[model samples]
Target chain A: MKRVEGLTHSYRFSWFALILAALGSGVLLLIVAPLAALVLSTSFGELSQAAADAQVIQSIRLTLSAALTATLISTVAGIPLSYVLARKEFFGKTALLAIIDLPIIIPHSAAGIALLTVIGRRSLLGSVTGGLMGSAAGIAVAMAFVSVPFLINAARAGFLAVPERLEKVGRSLGASPWRVFFTVSLPMAWRDIVSGMILMWARGISEFGAVIIIAYHPMTTPVMVFQRFNDYGLAYARSVAVLLIIICVAIFVVVRFLARPTQEAQDA
Target chain B: MLELRSLSKQLGLFTIADLNLRLNHGEYFVLLGPSGVGKTVLIEMVAGFITPDAGRILCEGQDITNSPPEARDFAVVYQDYALFPHLAVAANIAYGLRARGVQSKQAAARVRALAEKLNIAALLNRRVGGLSGGEQQRVALARALAPRPRLLLLDEPLAAVDIGLRARLRHELRCIHQQTGTTFLHVTHDPDDALYLADRVGVMLEGSIRQVATPQELFRAPSDAAVAEFLGMRNIMTVDSASEGVCQVGRVEIHAALADESTSYVWIKPEEILLSRQPFDSSARNQFRCVVAGWENSGPLLAVRISSGDLTLTALVTYESFSELGIDAGTELYCTFKSSAVHCF
Candidate 1:
């Protein structure tokens, strides 16, 4: 009886272990498949050529510049709004938070259409501004509009987690409100702010539906890939797509490496 | 000296109506209360974080009612020891000095001197996040005290500390208060804090100072029933004044000195009631034959709940007294307490 009980217990433990291993392996497979395929199919020479292609290079530069601009705008404008939403209490605060998060829940294509209706040439705002269409400025605005909520919400959560007592202490120490924000609140929430910015930049970079509706001529990398697939074929498109993927992966790796130590220290 | 005259504020459901207080220079004044009694709000008003609806705050006869926190020249220490996590211990200590535009050399010197005084010199370069709770508290005190504000407002500084460390930190805080001679307006919910630290204690209830007196006075003779109950008075009995120096309680004529003509209630400290196995006593005005209804053994003291006729009173006795008097449930004993120990209200 003891032997039988031991065998049954061992079987249960083995089954549990097996289930976990299988789920973990499946997740790993799903993640690695596309990257492995990209690497395997493209030769180094083909990658180098694709990297040097003028259209690919232009698209990459545009994507990076536009994403960076959006990130800067989001950081500057989103942080203060996030702080307000996080800390202070006023009338209509819940409604205001909902309004900030509206873009995230809406369909991206609808967001694009909404932007076009407001800022496109035929619209009243567009007519007043006189043609923001097909320009770098228009792309940045559209990307920022769709991507800023992520940054703001992330920053708000971060700022909310910081104890209000810390700021009170700062005030009691004779630091002005502005001084407290800059010295204490800002630094404590910096990790979250940076992570939010990164997420915003990533979202902005990948944005194709909104950018296509507002400004298709400038062609960010994602839009360029779509255009290439339509103009030529999947083979030509794959090379450029693979190149963009590599660039994104490298950037992500660098950012993660730089941010990891600070995160660990914060945890400690 | 600090004075708050007719301070009033209404925040949501809580309100403070015309609260007033005065603290002398170098005196440690403690505000004692239960939670949500506007103690924190009062401290905040004094610290200049929250402006009062109508009032004038004066420091040494200077009106600072409308002054900003930075210009108010007062420091506050919160219960949570709100040290900036991003700064090192030394930098945290030097923050107020730096804000005042003191030179770096002078700030460093001040930080070192204060850190040494607080016994936190060894933790100077360590980050605030790395320090223990007691260490963090000392660092916070060092930082707040380094600038030497005219008044220091402490909002329950020892509330967040561990139980064992609380006594040590209380001693340290008392020492700091003495060494610096800074006027401290401390807020707390613990009577022991008021007893050990404050030169005078103010009991606050519902946004009002019910009574302000020395710890001994507050404990021995609270102003009213609520204040007495708050100060841990366990035995409160209704008494009909029969004569000049006598009162009737449950068919027993207890001798009590009537200080007020309209006195209707009497309060006695639990520890003031003496328990004797034999019926022998001297001039302890009130004496009754009581049976021990129940007893609770609190560490180092036995709390005996005694019933005399229809009236019950709790008395605290030493473990030795409990054993020597053979006190237990249903044990008949004689209870006597001095008339002066009975506070009439």
Candidate 2:
């Protein structure tokens, strides 16, 4: 009986199904071919040489740490703002939402310039921040400026998913508003907020245009790649690019392994 | 004791205007209304979540209308239960205690004790998302009752529980209310929920309290036509004339014991009307000759709809009586009722 059913199903679908699967594979190859070729083109000896270089290692460390710092700062400051945007309605709420989304749409170089005007020693905020131009702090500031929208928007969507009734129950149970936020809203939004943090961090580390414009002297990994390509050639930059991609892929795989929704049934 | 005096708010076209009510300490009061009649809004107001546009809420004879919900010493169980999805059953139950600075060991002990009482001890470590509707409701009750709150508010608590478990949960709620001795103000749209649990019920419609009485009183003697219509009363008519203890309604004179010159309407319930093949002697003063307009089986009994002149009256009869009298639609019958059963308003 099963064999008969299978024959009837595949007779109707076999060729069409094969062609559909081939189309999907073609798209996958379109994305995978360049990265595979980039890695394959670099001889192992060359990869080792790039790996051994002290400057390359230091730049990698600097990039990862700065990205993490930027992500941390965004989370601490953005979660509350995200919650407010999710729950409250007042004057100019739509305008505020649009403004929060502006960083993601504006050109990275323009974003770098905007950051500079506010933190370039000549401006009031620049003096307050001790003139962060061409410094690691400036690099982090540029990266955060370009990437914070991802964190805020993701966290806001997470907060919006938590029902208002849950929060009201918390308050009715003799919990203060602050307690309700900490215990009820924040924990419920944890998964989305954490994923957003990871995305923001990944986006921050890849920031070449904005960081190079704002703080080139610090020589983050992306800036170093550009410099190596200019001084030497394609062979030099390709290896570093491959190394950065490997590190990003490794970290993201671990994060995804941790974040995949558990099979356990969730509460209503 | 709790009192709401002139509680008023405008929610975009629907208005809760001048709602005044009082509940004695330890009273189980129900605010009954249909869905979207602003029942939940009133519960929120009493819980101090929303500040009323005009009113004063008094608890223990002190005004607390402006107090925040946290300071009100009240607990609420929502229709959806709203158990924290991230927390385990024990943690959800212990949340109120922990928020109030209860010690870890003490809170854990109290959570366990409450879980035991609610028959959910085995589920203390289970995640809320994995529980069934009945289990979630039990957890919600345990959570709200853990802190021994001064006042408990229930918003259609049995809405999510299945029919099989509703009666059991309702009995448990009554037991819990007695054990805790806390004032309970439960709001529900279910007639059975109110009748089973409420010591006194306030019928609310269009954001106003129409009448406040016991379940029997509210069913037997509703104050107005609207209340009668809401409670499923059908034998209502305008009184053309009212004199000493008698009112002429739709060309039939109904002997209403409470009738006076001021009365303008009369309400008669279906269960109070008796059906028979012939008129017999009885203390019931009001009797009418009616035709069997319709008959419907309501489980063990039958609801017989009878029409007399222009007035329609519903009378209920047992299955035995229905068979003994050979009653059916289009049969002539005599409907008898007490004059006291005729409510005049």
Candidate 3:
């Protein structure tokens, strides 16, 4: 009986495995093919030239710094909001969730217009803060405006995965509400929150339409690529894109390497 | 000591209305109920997670109706154990102590002491995610006990444990209650938890506590039909009429010492009845020539259903006697029980 069952199981497994591999490799090819073509189109000399160009270097730096600042600010503010959304059921919760997802749903250029209405020059918030137009602060705001949903949604999912009973138990053990949040809830959800921040930072680095409208002078890498494509040609633009992609990929790999050990230990 | 005075709460369609209970200090009290009976909600209220709509929660004569869960100092061990996956077993145990601002050295010492007491010393350095259910339970217990809370509320602590380990865990819980002398308010749907671990058992039906008594008293005498049925008393028969010390069950008249004018039903403990092939003379007030209707294997005891006239009674006979009598369907048997064994309510 066992031998017969094993034969049937292996027969079914082979077919399932073949289909799974085919579907998985299809996705892999779709993602990798364009990136590989883009990278291969630019020679090593051209990549080095773009890396050495002071304008390209400045834009990359500005992009990284602005994205990092936006991510840090969003993380500080979004975590609490995410936790609340995950744990609490209040009036307007669905509306609040929809509002959080608005940036993702709307066009990036329209999102830029909305941010300008809120914090650009002559707006109430802008007048209060002495305006953020054509400034690094404006660039960070545009990046944050377009990319914050990823962080909020991921953190919310993480917080939601944590059992409410654990928090209740933590409180019953004499921990204050704040203590429970920091010691129990925050630690449990840290991995998802960190990954969310990474995604937000990556999205912010590649932001173009919103940043172009808000602060084009302190150009991010994506805006610089567009500017160079219009002013110069496709070859120059492609080299800079290659440089940005390499830097982003390198940073992503390093971050993933740093995060892998704790995840592996937990899984083991 | 803890006291709940006319506690009431409206949670959607379920209403815990004007409920009252008092727990003596150092007593192991178990609340037995069916699932969705608002048992967890009641304890959560006592733990200060849910505020009672109108009630006074007095702990050792101090009112704490509105205290936060932390301020109430009542630790809860949830059904799932809910051990922190991010922490090691030792860290999990030390959580309460750290929350109470205990010094690190002292907290570590306390954690070690709890681990030793719970026989989980070896697992202290291991992560909680990989621990078995039993190990997680011990760790949760250690964590709840670390700060020495005045009351420990256990919400179905044994429900998730394997059946083979439940008995041992129940014994351990009894021992821990004795050693700590903390008022334990354990809620569970499993009757074994109440029978084995409770100093006093409260039977909850719907949202209200129907009766509270010692384990023996609860088994021997339940206050209502709901409570009796909840305790697995399957031989309850409606009393058509009662006079003096006798009650009419269908067309059969049975002698019960406790049957009164207001007695609506009479319940006989299955184990208390004796089954014999021949009519053996006994001092029992109730004796009937019954036919063996059906039999079911119930561990060491054979649950033999006997029908006498229109009345049917369940009797638990040892496997030895059952096979000796060679009883089967339609086999003639004489079942006997004393009037003292019958309880009417």
Candidate 4:
């Protein structure tokens, strides 16, 4: 009787696993199938030609530079705010968190419009700083406005994972608050902050509606792809899209490799 | 030496009010209490991690109440050790020295000396993540002692270790206190930790220090019922009335050498009560013919609960005597103790 029961149990386990695999493959294929088709459809000659094109190269450079700028600025400003959110409780804390998440929730074009009212020509900040419209700075601002929440939230989670007792021990050891932050808190949370920066940079690189509405002349890669698809058709645009995806993936892989925690950090 | 004068803090739902304590230099003082008595808050206040709402903390006659934790020359070894997970054991030991602007070469020497003394020399190069609980504790001790602070605050440093390791660590803590000559203020809820480690123990209750004395004194004479109860004397009985040195408890009368007219409760350590099958001709002033109500094996001793009329008493006896007396539920026995063993408050 026990043998028969065990057999039936094994049979049920296999059946459940098979169902899970089948359902999982549907979502996996939905993502991989299109990406595979896009890469395969573009010939090597077309990919090389698109990569060598001066306009395509310039747009990619602009996209990389603007996204890098946005990511750097966000990392510098967001880490302190993230640590505060992780370690403190105060009035309006929930509301402040909602505000931080607003960029991710709002439509991209609306985010762009919101950016314009502050930094566009004839606005208060714009008049003080001269116009930012049609400039790379405007593209960076728009990308940052939409993507910064990723970095803040991720870093906040990183800081949250660190036990407050560790920081207290650091301080009691005669290390100042700032020293404790740099040596204890930052190193422990380093992996999460790095991952958050990568996510923010990737999100900024893929921004289109915000960048287009804010700066059209200094065309980013996504904006150029959209314009090329509208003006020259899918074949021409597919080559550029393929090149961008390849470059982004390669850089992502390299950064991920470089960002892995050291032996000591892994122990942490 | 350290002193806290009228230290008070209002934490959520709990308040540590008008707490005052004094610590002599080069002594191992333990703040012993049950859990959730705000012991951690008081320790943190002394360590300068949590600021007291009202009071002054004096170190060598200098007020340091408003100083940041870094400015206070005190180190803490938390219950979980809180070793820096991102650093090697050597690095963790050298951290406080590095913060104090000590050169790497000098700091490395101090770290090695500490590791050698703590018997963690083999673990210097290893990361803290995979260390045994006892090893982590030694590393934490080394790190805290690196800068040689005036006082060391240990918040239940042995609470996480296994029972055997805890005993060994307790011995090591005493050795370190004597070797370093650093005033140690260790806090714990476990009375065993207090009994095994402390040169002097303070009984904390309701967020205040109720009594402070040597461990023997705290055991022999607790200031109040709360102190006696916390000290593992479970035989506290309410007195109906007290006159001179005798008190009435239920139908049985207890003669206490320490009882006075104002006494409302009488207490005796379970081990002080003797259990026997026959009455003995001895110096015991209090005696009762009790029926064994229940008994439990408590390690090497047997804890027997007995009833005499309407009053119950817990008496601890050696297993040898337990079997000799044939104590079990409904077994008639005589329990006796000297009048001096019964404390009244």
| Candidate 1 accuracy as lDDT | 0.87
Ranking by DockQ: 4, 3, 1, 2
**Residue range B53-95, candidate 4, lDDT tens digits:** 9989999999999899989989999999999898899999999
Tens digits of per-residue lDDT, candidate 1, A108-209, equal 888989899899889998999986889888888889989999899889998997889888888778888998899889988887888898889888988988
Q: Which stretches of model 4 miss by more than 4 angstroms?
A: A1-15, A262-268, B238-251, B254-310, B315-345
After superposition, candidate 3 runs with Cα above 4 Å error: A1-27, A128-130, A261-268, B240-245, B255-265, B269-345
Worst 10 residues of 2 chain A by lDDT: A259-268
lDDT of 1 by residue, B1-345 (tens): 999999999987678988889999899999999888888888888888889999899988999998888888899998887888778899999989988889999999999989888889999998776788899899989989888898899999999988999999999999999999999999999999999998999999888899999998887677877877787667887766555666676687767776455667787888899988877759888888899999997777988999998688999998877888887789999999988887776
lDDT by candidate, in order shown? 0.87, 0.89, 0.91, 0.91
Q: Give all candidate RMSDs, comma-separated.
A: 4.0, 4.6, 4.2, 3.9
Order of candidates by TM-score, top first? 4, 1, 3, 2
Residue B236 error for model 1, in Å?
Answer: 3.4
Alpha-carbon error at B216 in model 1, in Å?
3.2
Fnat, model by model in order, equals 0.63, 0.84, 0.82, 0.86
- Can you write out model 2's per-residue Cα lDDT over B1-345, one digit (the tens) per residue? 999999999877668999999999999998888888988889999998788999899999989999999988999999889988888899999999998999989999999998888899999998887788788888999999999998999999988778889998899889988988889999988878778899999999999999999998887667888887877666788889998799998788999999999888888777899888899999999888889988998877798888998778777789888899888889998989999998887
i-RMS for every candidate (Å) is: 2.0, 1.8, 2.0, 1.5
- Which wins on TM-score, candidate 1 or candidate 4? 4
